[model samples]
Target: MTTTATAAPGAHLPEHLDFLWRSPEPEKAYDVVIVGGGGHGLATAHYLARNHGITNVAVLEKGWLAGGNMARNTTLIRSNYLWDESAGIYEHALKLWEGLEEDLGYPILFSQRGVLNLAHTEQDVRDSVRRVEANKLNGIDAEWLGPDEVAKVCPIVNVSSDIRYPVQGATYQPRAGIAKHDYVAWGFARRADEAGIDLIQHCEVTGFHVGGRDGDSVTTVRTTRGDIACGTLALCAAGHSSTLLDQLGIAAPLQSHPLQALVSELLEPVHPTIVMSNAVHVYVSQAHKGELVMGAGVDSYVGYGQRGAFHVIERQMAAAVELFPVFARAHLLRSWAGVVDVTPDASPIVGRTPYDNVFLNCGWGTGGFKATPGLGWAFADTVAHGRPHPLIAPFGLDRFVTGALVDEHGAAAVAH
Candidate 1:
């Protein structure tokens, strides 16, 4: 249960209880209403109220704060996609991360150890070189590193110089790194709550009370218990976006898929820089506490299900053990899975939907967690002005309608 401390009227300004311990009464209609109390939703609300003049806002979360994929991500931060638009925008996210702690006045524990994407075959090498050139041309710091260099960064990798699937090289982005996940969410939440945004937890959206036949407006959102009147709605529901949109007759071009991540027992910090390989279909990194965090491909099919067959985990372990001999002896500690909503082009679909006031911020594939802050900023701009930000123009939902997809599927496999 969520605990609440009573405050004098107008003490916790926006909607009284800061984080809204109870839905309380709708009190008054808000300027903006955000769905899914995850990081993106919370950060957008924070930016909207603090950065813009839109203070009257209500954030509706189906469950507790940031308990969805925002909490389940592997925490690998990077902007080294194969395309410039993808890299440039995500790089902007990297810059934002550099100042997150100060902006939130909270320690985020960001680590800039860099990311190492490995190439195991000739094709892998070609793709790696092509990507490195693409990234460098885009002003992102990316370079090709051979096996000898890969050893310098990831010495623990059990790679043979001349063996089959030999490590041809790697793409290193010194600008990419990892940050504390929950801290990001909490940092955004604390600031938004302090700034007078109503954060409603456990307020599942039962349906929508949309106005205007064009579906370009929202009158109010019917909740499990109450109806919230708001000028606009932003959906940051991720894996649940399509389902939520379906409730309002808005068809989202996204489908949900399950992705699993596992962590090993605490060991001496054996892994340093993040390591990813498409050939192996595995990627891993070690946390400050020494737990080895790892992930593989997502389930092929679509479902809200978070559980997958044990064989998927088994497949991932084989590759991990082969790459790093040390992992062969480490005891497995825990494994968990999350559902992800993917768009056709493997990029996030940001900005306006058919519904005038309802905006979408989903489809990061495996890269949403770290993109939270920047997405928050851009998304808030769109909602406040009812216009798309130039930086995120390529990812508009209408891109699909116009055949202007910026496909980054090749680099996105290990992107986040």
Candidate 2:
């Protein structure tokens, strides 16, 4: 493990991050095997070593580390959901995000610039206010701000009544903000690597060998690199989770969709706070580098493609211009997409699978990046004890059949 100097507060990030984690060859077997090297998997591995003292672990990534959704997300972090179950997990993650920099001994560039989920219609106002009350009951900081107050938070937004979807109000979370996605991934990777965990790249898991008496447990994971035996297997593959679950003959109701996001050319910082409008179907925030980081709902169609349809981008920009009139002249820099695994209720599925010693952590959709630290903490405990953590117990696979789903479609504010 190498020790890199932490940047001063509000200082510019290094042009190039020094090699923080070692690239080690995958061993034939390990105590725990995580199938994705994204933020979630890396965080889980870090907590597995830090909390449980479990160091013999391997994180298998088909591509480069954090090159997947970890790099493609819009980088918004908030926990103002409308349900108790949703609030529990997300708020926990927000608390973890508040202290992540010092905990990782790395500069994550986490900014608590606050977030405002705008309401454009009467119904939007009703829903936003209701969610604000729910967040308050959950002990989360939330406030319902009128259009004028919304303007005070973000002056550039087009809040006049003349617009098609005029701002009625918004739900504001003062603690919510964004972080540097790449830095968050690298921070977790460095810590996990320091704990003697093997972070293996270009190692794709192709199949699974279930060899218990009743064929109820996975004994070995067959990867592109080679087969590796494991005592416990955890799937944190995000959009590609179904591909690996298919090898184990598990039928999970997961749909993979292309979630697109784009950034504008670097300019003077005009946006002061993060603004999101589910009615307009777009969200925008100013990054540390002065780029306007923006994104919208996922593509309607299901596919594994990393790039999204042009129509989605066109609609996203149209929505952005309508919400923020000043953004009309902003030059489009570049765009990219990530495959997100969505569930029927727009909530994640975490906990034990039908197979013994096999854990599942997917279906996070667009909210995965925000839930990195909290999910990692809970999932690591789940894997260590071979049981569902209380925080994630409500999101088990049985919810679909038992009619106990944590439906977040309407409350999620965005098509997660």
Candidate 3:
């Protein structure tokens, strides 16, 4: 909660430090109130201050900063989605990620080594080719790699046909890679704070006072801290999106499930680019600190617990060893899970609600971390202009009712 002021050149000040202060207490009213202080909400607040000149904004969090799903994700980022709508939004995020460090003046350990989605069956190859073609058509970089090319790109992967899900080919995106998830969240939080955005942690929203000329709009948000009035309220509560919306008598088409991930004991780099296999149901990537970060599908049932069943991790490890036999010997360092709010079509819901000046950005599912900056940029525009950005307009809640969902389950493989 404190930043040390760095010493000026040859001046008397703390070196490599900045001024420190406690987060301000919430005011009676803010121009805007954002629920959840995760990367998306923090980014949205930053953009509202930087782009829209909305400095009187407050971001409320139920826990300490970035203590929710933002801290629980495996930081894999990519934008090689199959659909144009999905591609557009994620690609915008990718571009923002490419320059995030410089923009935030914070090192997020951004690395664009590459990412490869392996193909195990003939149908997998066909789908990979189709997706690659679509990605190229949309101006997103993607290529289909044969077994030999896939092996060359990631030598540690077992490409032999002897395995259960042998590598037949793969879809490769050179721009895809991982970043420091915590750093990204903190960087945005720090910048948002500098922009005069109130980051009120431990301030859980309890309810809202709905009143307007039409008698259906949120005039004030009742929180653990106290009720605060706002002209507009944006919800970015991720897994708890439904819980928060229910307080307003609004129901979102979101199903919450636990998605787990684990990191192996640190070792010398053996894995190269990020490797994934929908057929085997595991994805592996090495973190900046040398731990093998791995993840797979979510649990079948719905749950609010932030931890998942042990068998799910066991199965994922079994699949990981099947693909990379070397990983069988690696000891698990730690494991955790994040509750994700998934939509039926595997796409995000970003748009206005039934009530005036009440916006919702949820149902990002497993791929929310990768879309942080883009969501912030677009959602900020949405809240500022009172309409969604064109990139996210198609992902509105109406898509579910109108049956225009953009299904990307295949592209968002391994629960991100």
Candidate 4:
């Protein structure tokens, strides 16, 4: 049976009471309205209040909090990119990950176990060398390790020449690792709520009410529950970014695709660090509970369905066994997929749209999870000051026409 209770306004609930017990109903107007409640959106709201004192905010989610891509990734973190633009933003996120737990006052289980991107062929070696050099130039910590060094770092990897894709060498980032994905979302959500930011779930945005000169401003948002007037509207929707933008008669350069990941039954710890192989199309790291968290490339076609084909899973399993032959006997626990928004250049878009008051932070492709804190920090700065932050200005939508894309396809395509 459903139970209801009432308390005096502004009264704090007991510690044992659920956080949802005191959640306020959505207000009719807000200074800022965030259209998605994933990690990025929640983080944006938190920073908006914590950094800028913009507490009159609303975060609208179509489903339960953190139920989207925030909960559906393999949880790998890294900042070793080839370009300066990509390196700067992602490296910013890596730094934030260092102090995030203390900042949020929540346990996120961020482990700096290191990440190894294995190279197999001659081209892979060349790419690794170039990327490590560029990363160093951008003040990112990166190193190219030979096969012998790779084996020392990760003792179980099959560096033998007999494998389908031999591990010729690898690029290692000692700071790159994995964190608890769900905890990341919940931590931000809890902190945002504590700062009086409304987190409205099960509220789907139906259309946008655009007004002002040439309809360049979004005055209100029409959602399933009701209309909400807002001074500024920020779109942080991941795969559904294009759908929501289309309601405003704006088109985003994004395509939605399914990215698959799986976990194996719990076992004793054997994998010491995160391992990824682009040639074999697989990447893996052992979870805190000893489950082997694994993933590969995205599906070839566009899909809104949160599932991939069996053949894709089959190929990923083949690749996993090819790299770590000891994983051949591990039983599968669960497998699932999340819809990711892809762009032509394989980088994120995080700036103002053509609209005067509407901003977008989509096109993260398959790498959005690692970029959550950085995206939120820059996006909140953009929405607060009506200008893109210097760190993310290079990712503006104007780049598509100006032909100044910060293409990171070589690093972002696989093993995000």
Best candidate, lDDT: 2
User: Which candidate do you rate higher for lDDT, 2 or 3?
Assistant: 2
TM-score of predicted structure 2: 0.95
**Model 3 ranges off by over 4 Å:** 1-21, 410-415
Compute the lDDT of residue 230 as modeled in candidate 2.
96
lDDT of 3 by residue, 269-385 (tens): 888889988988888999998999999877899877777678998898999998888887999999988888999888999999999899999999989999999999999999999
The lDDT values for all models are 0.80, 0.89, 0.86, 0.86
Q: On a 0 to 1 TM-score scale, where does candidate 4 land against the true structure? A: 0.94
Ten contiguous residues minimizing lDDT sum, candidate 3: 1-10
**Candidate 2: tens digits of C-alpha lDDT, residues 1-52:** 1111121233322336446878888899999999999999999999999999
- Angstrom error of the Cα, residue 240, model 1: value is 0.1
The residue pairs in collision within model 3 are 3-18, 4-17, 4-18, 4-19, 5-17, 5-18, 5-19, 6-17
The clash numbers for all candidates, in the given order, read: 1, 0, 8, 0
**Residue-wise C-alpha lDDT for candidate 1, range 174-248, written one tens digit per residue:** 877888787788788888877878787767778888788765588888886588888888889888887777787
Alpha-carbon error at 317 in model 4, in Å? 0.4
Per-residue accuracy of model 4 over 1-416 as CA lDDT, tens digit each: 10011112333323553553235678999999999888899999989998899999999887767677888899999988888888888999999999999999988999999999888899899889888998899988999999999999999999898877788899999999999998898789888888889988767888878799787799999987799999999998888888887787777688888899999999999999999988888999999999999998789998777776889989989999889889999998989888889988899889988888898999998789898898888889999999999999999988989999987775532528
C-alpha-based local distance difference test score of model 1:
0.80
